[model samples]
Target: MPDTGRTMYARVVEHTCDDCVPVSYELCAAGGLMFIRWTDRTGGGKPVVRETERLISSRAREMWRDLLLGLVR
Candidate 1:
C-alpha cells in the first residue's frame, strides 16, 4: 500500500478453495475513507489486484454502531 500520510489500519483475509483459485481481501481505513482490495490468481497466471474506496458516511457509522451493540449479526 502506498503511504497516504495518515494513520491507517488494515485487515487481510485469505481463502483457499479446492475447486477455485485462492483469493484474498484487504480492508483498510485511513483519511476518513475505507479502502477495499481483492486479490486473486486466475488460470495459474500472475496475481490480480482490484481496489476501491468509499467515503465514510453517517449511515455507515450507524451500521458500525449497531454491530457494536449486537444488533447486527
Candidate 2:
C-alpha cells in the first residue's frame, strides 16, 4: 500500500497467476470516505469499485430530527 496526498486509493493486485498484476494498496485518510474494489470472472480485467464522498454529522440529534421532520412535511 502506498500513501497519496489527500485521497486514498488501492490498486488491483493479482497473485499466484503469472498474468495477474500486483496492485498497490492504500488506506483511507482520516475523516475521509472509504472505497471498495473487486474482480470478475475474467482472467484479466480492470478492477471494479464504487466512488464515495465525505460524510457529515450533526452536533445535536434534535436539530437533525427536526430538520428531517420539516422536510418530510
Candidate 3:
C-alpha cells in the first residue's frame, strides 16, 4: 500500500500553511526563489506555496532531488 501517512502529512502541511497564512505576503518570492509553502507566521496569506525549480541553488537542488529519490524507496 502507498505510504498514506506520509502523503497525508504532506497534504496537511500544505493545507495548514495555506489556510492559516494571510493573503498579503503572497509574493513571487525573492531572488527568483519560491516558497514551497509558508505558515501563518507572517499573518500574510502570502503565496505560501511556490517554486522556481530553477531558482534553487544547484547544490541544494541536487541534494533535495537525491533526498526525494531516497524517500520513494
Q: Each candidate: what lDDT?
A: 0.49, 0.31, 0.31
**Clashing pairs in model 3?**
21-45, 22-44, 22-45, 23-45, 25-46, 26-46, 26-47, 37-48
Instruction: Please report how far candidate 3 places residue 21 from its true position, in Å.
Output: 20
Give the alpha carbon lDDT tens digit for every residue of 2-44 in model 3: 1112221221112222455352122123343422322233533
Full candidate order by TM-score, most accurate first = 1, 2, 3
User: What would the per-residue lDDT of candidate 2 be over residues 1-73, giving only the tens digit for each residue?
Assistant: 1123345443322112324644322222234334222223343466533322322323222333443456411
Maximum-lDDT candidate: 1
Which candidate's TM-score is highest? 1
User: What TM-score does prediction 1 earn?
Assistant: 0.42
Candidate 3: global Cα-lDDT?
0.31
TM-score of 3: 0.23
lDDT of 1 at 24: 50
Q: Comparing 1 and 3 by TM-score, which wins? A: 1
